[model samples]
Target chain A: MTLSITDVTKRYKIRVTRAQVNALNGVTIDLPAKKTLGIVGESGCGKSTLARMIVGLEQPSSGTVTWNGEPIFDKARNMLSSKHSNIQLVFQDPYSSLNPRQKIGDSIAEVLTVHHLVEKDAVQARIAELLTEVGISPELAHRYPHQLSGGQRQRVSIARALASQPDLLVLDEPVSALDVSVRAEVMNLLIDLRERLGLTYIFISHDLSMIRHISDQIAVMYLGKIVESGPWDSVLENPQHPYTKALIAAMPDHTEVGNNAYEAPLKGEVPDPASMPTGCAFHLRCPIAVPSCSTNAQTLREIEPNHQIACQEVK
Target chain B: MSKPLIEISNLTVSTTDDNRTLVNDVSFSIAPGEAVGVVGESGSGKTLTALSLLGLLPRGVHATSGSITYGGKDLLTADRETLRSIRGNEIAMIYQDPMTALNPVMKLGAQLIEVIQSHGGDTSNAMERVLTAFSEVGIPDPKRAYESYPHEFSGGMRQRVMIAMALILSPQLLIADEPTTALDVTIQQQILALVMQERRKRNMSMLWITHDLGVVANLVDRVIVMYAGRIVEVGSVKEVFTNPQHPYTAGLLASLPKASDKNRTRLLSIPGIPPKPWTVGESCAFSPRCSKADQQCRSSLPVLATNTHTDAACFHLMGDNS
Candidate 1:
């Protein structure tokens, strides 16, 4: 595994006088070394924050983040050693990811300069190589972010991320803002890059169809916890958790309708995050909820050969 | 056969900025109890066409030359009073972001009640009327929600409130302008399903302006693909999705990852952004981007031609080139 997160948790103190709520509670997962791991959840699911922790942008409230089986939170050690240099992140909005004032070549060269990988004379040549690596012309390196299109801007962002030569890239909805018209092109670019560079990815998104197309493994998050985790096709086709089922069924694709309320056409609303349900966080709207779910919180357990679900009613 | 609900003839809307034309001689119509979707990239004038109906242009654009005839009455020629009645009471609209569209200070009940009363509906127990519409849109705890403000609701709930307001008057025509653009995928489904269900139950005409073809495929019956503020293609949903004639429509649909898709390569992108008004032509505007554009296409403006239920605005569409 290239990335292993063990018992990661984040808790935010409530303002306006209320008890603190746990956003992520004891989450653990392993992302294999060259395989893309997809994290699926709605907004406020703490997936992005977890991503921030993986990339060393945000410190986790409590727990350990292991990159290449090495501890990341050890402050003095991380600063002294270059062991944590193998992980990087790519943001959702390509337009904002770049520096508008600086040329695209300088934006990429700045990273290489900071890392002390290349000399000043070799920086321009490296910029040309990086630009071509992401499938953009070397001439585009002199252009501004605004001058480039969305797809081109995204390619520049990928080039910048690749300039560090990271083993894993934390992708936070990289294609969410792009037009559905260009979604496949961008996704295919990522696949091709992974093959050529041998980079692992932690792809986070709210779009199920996009997740299914790219991910090797899938994790379904409700509130903050991942209620279900398993291989992609099986988990999406036969979701064991009710929350996963609702999210999948909510998608208006070419889906065959099931008779149960599982395909009940996405009624009601996702509950408030401030004051969550007492037991199972999803029981308030779970179509398959039983009497036990309202009182006893369910733990994620393997229900099938590889599928794990966190629902009391699944049994 | 169904009668047309609205017919826009040679619609030419020009912006006030230096007499620049936004929509040039665009023509299409919506039939009663039919939903027509308009698809395009951002700034492609899709929103401009929908805003033309309500005269909701932001103080700088105007319909220079067009006849927006609705039920034998030219909306372009209607007086302020006549358009006011049609704008809200008869022709209701729901905007993209309900949280922003709704007044944050006002209670949802008071806001919905105001729409109902403004439309000349019975005003007694106005809050009850608001709650009933909320219930109709499947809002849970409608009574509690009736007393809540816009901020108190979630993103999806805020949209439901907007839908309730849009349908409170039960208008003859509903124009939902990107209602689910701000929502999550699941919430978007809930919102679309609610709006579609309400429209079907009322048997009202709908003009859904959005960019999601998957959405239009599920909700709308027909589609109108627009570019540079002109109607490029108008046809049945199945006809367009299955056999897209225009290169733009085909590219848009092909780029989207279908629900049943396995893995594939070579997703066809149109190479560049949609043409700006300055770059648009007197002839075929899409000719520049179309791989199949010929000498005839570059010299003449393509017209919307229909063979059976399939219609498109391309000269080479007759040659089975899609």
Candidate 2:
């Protein structure tokens, strides 16, 4: 396995001068090498938090995250980055990620400069190489982030991400802000880079359709936990978790309107994470919710040969 | 659907910045209760087309020529007071970001009530209308939410409140300019659900402007593909998705990430980038990316023409001459 997350739980002290919000509850997952894994959930569902923890951006309150058979966070060291460049995160907003005042070439070169990977004389060539790798023109090197279109800017951000040539990539909704035409370009670029570089990725996004398109393995997240995990086709075709099914049903086809797309619509908004409901966190919106669903919590159990689901009723 | 509710005939909306034309001779019409989607890259002028209809152009922007007829009245030549009357009353708009559109200091109820009182013809039932609109658009706690400030609500809820405010007047037409772009997929699904539910109930015409073809394929009845201030293709959503006439539209549709695209490989992309709006966009605006562009396409702009029911702006489309 490339990465393994064991019995992870996260809770943030969101004291808004009034009350606290419990962002993440308990979660566990395992991701294999040279593969793409997708995490799908509503916003504030702790999906991003799970990603943050894996990249050491946030420490798990009580859990362990292993990378390549080693404990990455050094739970003993407080998960602080004391110069471990093994993992890197590509954020959602390309517009904000790159500095407006800085030139595109300088922005990308800074990564290599900071990582101490190349000689000062070779920085310009490295920047141009990174830009070409992401399909950006060399002439755009002098332009600022604001001068580039949304798609071009995202390409620059990707180039910056690749500057370090890190082992594992953590992409957080990289193409969700782009237009449909540009979205495909960026997604294709990521897939191409992964193959060429032999990279491992933890792709986090709410666009299940796109996730389903690229992920080798799929992990359905809900309320800060992996409710279901398996092969892409298996999880998509026969989603034992109700949340997974609801998410699949909610996806609108590239050609039809909304009202007809879903037969059993997801009901009620996502409950605030701070005060999660008792038992299964997803029971409130589950179409097949039962009496025991709210009284007993379920753990991930191997229901099929390669699939795991966290509901007792599914097995 | 007997008569068109909105029509744009040779609409050329220009800006004062060096007399730059933002929407060039754009023309289309929306039938009563029909849904039309406008799509393009970032600078396609789709938003400007929507803004032009409502007379809500940013400061200094002016329409150089063309007619904007809504409900059989000329919205282009209409007086400021008349334009004011048409806005928010006949053509309500929901922007992409509701947080920036709403008043952070005011309660949801007061903002919605203000909209109702302004265009809804009365103040007595305004509160009732606000609550009814809130509940209608899927806000869970109408009473409590009405009293809460904008900051108290979630992003999706705030957008719902914004939708409620925009739709409370039951405008003849609704203009949603990427209303769900800032929202997550699930919440966007919900918002689109609510919008469609309300549309079905009211049979209101809609002008949905967005850059996501995947969304329009599912939401709109027809499609209008825009490029650098001009429309390239217009057709029923079915025709556009199944067999798009314009090369740009086809490229865009092929580029959407599909749930069923298994064995993932390099997604098909139209190489190069969309042209800048200035400099008249010599030849076709998409010649920079189109694989089919020839000598004629590089020198002159193609006129938009209608064949059967579908309309396309291309010198090479189906080898048609207009």
Candidate 3:
């Protein structure tokens, strides 16, 4: 039930130029069963790339993705077929993920039937049961995806992912596409499902509030490298890395806005991932970066028992 | 208080086919230099209300009855030429997605110049003005930004360009319709701060329409909650956010995951989704999902009755209005 990612790197070769794009560089993390690990970063930080690799949607260029200490993507063994069903991904866009022409019940039942998770005759009953569990009416099972609201569509997507009874659900901005009110609804549903079903979650988002709300553990990624990792509260409230501090400060809250004189900390936009700097990718934007920060890339070193930071400035 | 800048009374917008009302009898007024936020989920007519201020309702949709009085003139009755001149000159709008708002093929400089020239006076210093606008919006290397197209700029940069374009002319009123929703959270904060800074410097009236209550709390002075084509509640940001009167408003405020909500297991969410404009009858549009709904709430719609420092359209308020 434990999923471990060890020094995984993903490189995508450009079709025409043949230059390698290092989407992820030596990323490592341990996601234990029944605990939530939140991966947070801005766009082009390789959080989604790592998510894709974890769910077996994309193979890693180097390193291993092990489920219970066994590699899941070994080509010769074809471990994906055996391990893929245990991990599922819920995408950001519910509108495009589900087939427009298919009915909700048929879509959910299709996953069960493909994996043979349920008996043939009991498929219809199971579909209804799953629909109701996700807070959707059983009657809406016959309706098409378009007939459902955004919240309902997301629920249907979640039901499909839960059909195989995945132990780890990789939610990539699952509620980001939803409206504010419905986001709370879907988030609560996920919370309920995880407790009832005893599931582990890899929650990815650029929203700081959401990350702080759900993550038991958090890993802050920058340019494919995790700059900081620790228990959620420790990393968020007492952040070690300067980038994490800037990110937390930049969050728009009630008190932050009234002080109009407050200065914005970060400088410039994120650097192009393809042409990243030799040392720390965030050194260019890091306010407190030192001389050595530009030449040597820091590796994750444990400062506390479970807290690790990859910044050389943090002792 | 100073005279209200723009007053909207009984504004009803309807689709051409079957005259289905998308915005129903909405009334509110913005004070001069005040920031007002309109909040709701999709299909709440918040966008339509913002669009109606400039008489920019799409084809097949028109304001059936109501008056948008701004600067001693009715916007609904204003001529096309008047609207055309007022738009982007005295009243600018920033859309949700900067990608679609900008042209893909045209150079950023050219697009900006074209906008400045259309509200015509002189084209001699157009390049300088464009660069100035870019610098004002904190875009580094204005020369390179001018030469590049929209696609070359990132989402945050594109939005900055859009903001620069909107404010280049120094509009008296700015209607930003969910301008930061498409951006990352940090980027969204930057844009919100930028908008607030520019508004104060120019003393411009801003109507920020969004669904994020937390964002509204930070950015605006007053908040108006809209539901299925009607105004559910309106109050100061402090009053409404701290003590929301309408059930829908209360539900929306409770639903957000705040910094205070850390380690909490469940969020209080409204049970059902909003109803479609066509599906609703004479009853309160929110009664289907409202927990405190009674027989009267299901049969008759409530008018906006005055509450403590706020106005809400709910039959279950402490005072009996009907």
Candidate 4:
């Protein structure tokens, strides 16, 4: 099944000041069946907000998110419909995501029981199978979150997500909290699972290296806008947007030592989401911005067959 | 090397009550104006080693035996008064989280002034110095940032403020413990550039501790790899990254997802989690997870020895001949 998010915008209203925080501004993307779409952005760029909207955790303020031509949210009930269960989200911090007091097996079992995916009698066996699928020992099912290491806790988180048998998995920085070695293990597991189960993935991370490893398609986000989108190789090797180029350049390469000096591209930090810059959201930090860039809004336009960029200066 | 700026020899730090060793027999030296990067994973004792240098070990943890000599004086044995004089004047430090390091209630400018005044620095034109330091670190608007509190600034700006405060005294040495780990890649590049600029301007020595090998390769001249509270490998950045001698170093390098690897092969991950501090024994601490470990490796510890391209503490070197 295909997942389409069209012009999804999310705004959070500040309680005290009554000011609106523009989290996601007109985010639009389409993911075909069993394809991996990677979203890369710095903090406060609305990547996570888009993930939440895709998984039906939060409804969009102004647009629609559909799965197989059906809206995921029910307008009458004002909540997620039954079809939303096809999408599951795995968070970055495994320790906070898993319940501290509950046993690992119990957490997985709770998901299975709520979804009624397995019978009551076969619950224990199903739990064992799930644990084994994620490379965890079935014997440790009784262990609490504190007793397991970070890697094991993350495996349990994955197992819980798989209990729903989702068609789409939105991984929000799944391995960012993990160490490098353990991050490899989790990433490998994800690649294996996607192949075996024919799963669609929407991976979000700030790390370009990790994104390049698993993504088939890539989207670069900046201040609640997608500035670049294309095949992973095209977007990474010959980046079009200035922000994307800076991100690729800033990525530390061990082999390039002594040859390249550290250059800070795209000066200054990301602007505040509440009071975004006038025209292009990145005009404030764009190194090649013209005077008209401050007044003209930019939209994604196809440069190549499948590659798209949103910058005005890149002819 | 022109008189090593700081030399640590046989340094061992342990918890006072349990006598559990956290950093065991770790030793390295940073020459004057040289930048050294200490690389390790969590619980690898890299931070503890850096902390011991500044005499900032947490409560209940004490250096059991070692000598941290700086400029012909043993800082480990120095008195409180001498340490107080040397702390922010001759040596400065910035941590991973600037929010916690800074006082949230105080204005950024006032806090920086306090650091100068507490060190008995010149009181005249203190505001000017603070603003100058702020501008040097690329605070955009030094005057506006000076009046802002820690909570008001973003993560990147706060780290710049921390770097500004750490460099305000123009210390001879700066010990940065994962200072850019929490920042975005773009902001991290900015901070690294700032640190490089300041270090070059002052000819200052630096001990940068981080888990990222890519960051180490980009920033530091020399690299020291630590695992389970011991130095696994030591060499120049080019030698270590190009030709790693230790198995752990090789595994760490292999585990990183390289952008140049167009094939998208599976990452080579280390088998198990790092051993807890108390579980490390007399034998090679990484033997349990190392694929090349033998009975001899499990029975005895290996000291640092010369290898092909670097000095490594391993019975089975990766590319060694003879």
Candidate 5:
């Protein structure tokens, strides 16, 4: 059950104006079964747009997103109907995602009953089992979302996602809102669940440490395009793109304090997606940008085995 | 050595409803030109501590006991007029969200100048001072940014504007409460660097409150770890990070998903949530989540014991009285 995204592009046309904003441009990736592919970028770098496209929440303006080589966005078939139980998305904010008035147990039961994943008589037992599997007490299944703490509410969100029996989970900033200790608990739970359920993940977060910790493969996005992608170690240890290097350099290292002065490789805000700079979107902030970088746009090119970078300066 | 700039002793905050203590017997100090980071999870009372320094705690919370001594004068007992004079002149603050912290209807220049004028400084030189501050904090084209409203600036830019506002008066101390939590990684680096640079340039002391240990490790000269409204550990950054005596501190460091641990999958997380202030008992507050806790730990609370390098509030630690 592989999920493949090929040359997917998404653009939003502004209302009351004759302007278009490109959210995701020419994105291509493959998610093999039971593997984690981490996507990281700044706030407006279109990571969420790609996640929305994959989950059938937003259709791409062009290109294709397929499951087992079948286009999931075909107009002939209902969106998310044929692939509802196979894929799911875990949202970033647990507080806003869950229904305020609904009990957590009923929430899970709704997904199960709506998808017809289980029989009516066994739904309550399945809800209790799902709640316990995500490290929440089965008794809390009766409590409302507000009654639970932030960590517990996030666990309930995960349980709701799991009730659909998804093979692939697109978790958007799953643990970013959690405290450090609670974040670890959630990450550990995800690791255990992935192994137990054989689930693939497209984990999206702006946190580099969490991405490096969980992802087998990583893709770095900038201005609606992927600038770098490769195996986790290769990309993190020997990053080829300037944007990736700047991100690595910007991550706070505990050992560097009082030992040496800090060095930020890049500065300045990311360009507006609507009016992105020509050539490389990161060229404006690239420390080593050359003369030709302003006019020559670069595409993802394989520099080494399985390592790709999209900068012309990298020989 | 020179005299300490600020001394807070036995600070305690309680709610008006039941008089339950939310910040209990907390004490720390900051020397001139030093930076201290207060780190804790939500409800650990770190934000309350920072707010108490300026007497701006939210409604329903009140400071019951403590002496906030600024330059050998008690601020907690000072009259409202004294606090008003010292607030923007001698001490300044920046909050977590700059968007809401700033006024929406006023121009950036008007807000910046208002802070200077309200402190009774020379109003004639206010515009010049605002532009100098804006440029100093790396706001490009300060002249243009001054005329724009708060909504016109980006998140990082608005935070820079907040920094400019805080430093315009040349305060001796700056209290930043989660200043960089809302920023992206690259922009957070920029803001941290800007703050540190300004701190050195002005020779000012700082009290930073945040939850990210990694940020605290890099930016602060000293660290104070709080839990359940009590100081769990206090030490220099090197001492605490290298050798954490408290189990809670160790749990926090271990729980982080480090970049170096790429090959490792399972994270070593401390089980259970932090105890609420209302649910706290006579025993150590962290005993429920601590693996090394014993009968004594669950029966009585421990005072902060001192060593050559660090101070920790744990009975099992090898240390004498502070």
Candidate 6:
């Protein structure tokens, strides 16, 4: 079973201004079973849009996203097909994701009931099993979302996602909203669960350190495009794209803190997607851009084995 | 060292309604041109400590006992007029979100000019000063940026504008509470560089409050670790990062996912949640979550004592002694 996203593009129309924003432009990726694919980018980089498309929450303007050679979206019905339940999305803010008035157990049981994953009589036992799998106490099932701490609430969210018995979990900045001490525990839980359940993950975050820690393959995105993609070690340690290099250099690592030779590599913020710069999307901020960069469009091309970059300057 | 730029002694902040202690007996000092980083998780009272220096505590919160002395003047006891004069002129602050800090309807340049005029600065040359400040912070098109509204600028540009406004007077001290936390790493580095450059140019002192240890390691000279409203550890960056004494501090540093680690092992997370402000008793507040907590740590409060590398409030210290 493999997940393939081929030439996907998403566009959003502004109601008041009637302007279109090109969120994702021609992004492609193939993830083998049980492998973690880390997608990283700054704000407005269209990572969230791609994640939404993959989970069938939103359909792409163009191209196809398939799981096990079956399209997740049903074009005729204008809704996600039955196979979409195999993929679940865990959002960034746990506080807003869970229903405020709902009990934690009921929230998980809702998924189980909707999917008909278990018998009605077995729903309570399944909820307890799900809670324990995520390292939450089964007794807290009666507690409301507000009664639980941020970390516990996130665990409940995970348990709710697990209640569907998903094979691929699209975690969108799962630990970003968490406190520093609690982030580690949640991350460890995710890693442990992934190993035990043989689950594949599409982890999305702006944090490169967290990405580096959890990812098997990594893709770096800029304005509406994947600038680089490769094995995690190769992409991180020996990056080809200037944007990828800038991100790695900009990360605040304690190991490099003692070295006073540090410098900010990137120059400017991400430009508006509606009015993207001509040629390379990153040419305006690229430190190594030539005059021709402004006129030449760049596309992802294999620079080495399993490594691809979208840049005209690199040999 | 030349007279300390700012000294905060025995500061205690609490709620007016319940009198629940938020910040307790926090004391530290920053020398001129030194950058000090205050690090802790949420509800650690790091922001309350910084806010007390400027008398900007929220409506329900009040500092009951503390002395925030700057240049021999206690800001806590100072009159409104005295504080008004000292606020933007001698001391400045920048927050995590520039959008909330800035006026959305006003043009960026006019807002900056307003800050200048409020500090009794020359209004005639205010536009030029604003443009110069914008360029100094590395805003690409200052003329266009000057005419734009706050909503027109990106998050990074908005932050640069905030820094420009804060440093227009070349204040002697700057207090930044998670100024770069809302930004991406690429933009965060730019803001950090810009602030450090301006600080060096003016020989300014700074108190940087953040939960990110990596930022503290990169930017600040000294660090103060806080937990449940009290200081847990204080020392130079080299001393503390190399040899953390307090268990909480050690746990925090260990919790981070380092790029340097060759093995991707499980993080050593601190066991339990932080205690509520009202629940904190006479004993060490971190005792409940601490792996090394003992009978003494739970029965009685520990005061900051000189360790080999840093001053830590812990019965069981790590590093050299351990």
Ranking by DockQ: 4, 5, 6, 3, 2, 1
**lDDT per residue, candidate 6, B57-164, as tens digits?**
999999999799997899999988888888889999999999878999999999999999988998898899999999999998999989999988888889999999
DockQ-wise, the better of 5 and 6 is: 5
lDDT of 1 by residue, B22-90 (tens): 877878888888878887767678888888887776688888998898867898888887888787788
Clashing pairs in 2: A21-A274, A22-A274, A255-B217, A256-B218, A257-B218
lDDT of 5 by residue, B153-227 (tens): 899999999999999889999999999898989999899889988988889999999998888787778999999
After superposition, candidate 1 runs with Cα above 4 Å error: A75-84, A254-264, B117-122, B263-266, B318-322
Q: Put down candidate 3 lDDT per residue, A1-315, tens digits, no spaces.
A: 788999999999889887778899999899889999999998889999998888777888999998777676653145334533777899999899999999999999888887678789999999999998898999999999999999999999999998887788999999988887788889888888989999999999988778887889999998888999999988987899988888887776642332344346676777888788878888888888898989998899998879999888876
TM-score of candidate 3 to 2 decimals: 0.95
Comparing candidate 4 with candidate 5, which one achieves the higher DockQ? 4
Going through the candidates in order, state the TM-score of chain A alone for each one.
0.92, 0.92, 0.95, 0.96, 0.96, 0.96
Compute the interface RMSD for each candidate structure: 4.6, 2.9, 2.6, 1.3, 1.6, 1.5
Better of 3 and 6 by DockQ: 6
Better of 1 and 5 by TM-score: 5
lDDT of 4 at A23: 94
Off by over 4 Å in 3: A75-84, A254-263, B262-265, B318-322
Best by DockQ: 4
- Candidate 5 structure quality by residue, lDDT tens digits, A1-315: 788999989999778675778899899898788999999999889999999888778888999998777776562247335435577899988999999999999988889887778889999899989998998889998899989988999999999999878888999999989887899989988889999999999999999888888889999999899999999999999998999999998887664555525555677999878787888888899999997999998899999998999999999
* Model 4, position B2: C-alpha lDDT score: 81
What lDDT does model 6 reach? 0.90
TM-score of model 3 (first chain only)? 0.95
The per-model DockQ list reads 0.40, 0.51, 0.54, 0.71, 0.68, 0.66
- What is the per-residue lDDT of model 6 for residues A152-243, given as tens digits with 9 covering 90 to 100? 99999999988778899999999999999999999999999999999999999999999999999999999889999999999998999999
Worst 10 residues of 5 chain B by lDDT: B313-322
CAPRI docking class of candidate 6: medium
TM-score of each: 0.93, 0.93, 0.95, 0.98, 0.97, 0.97
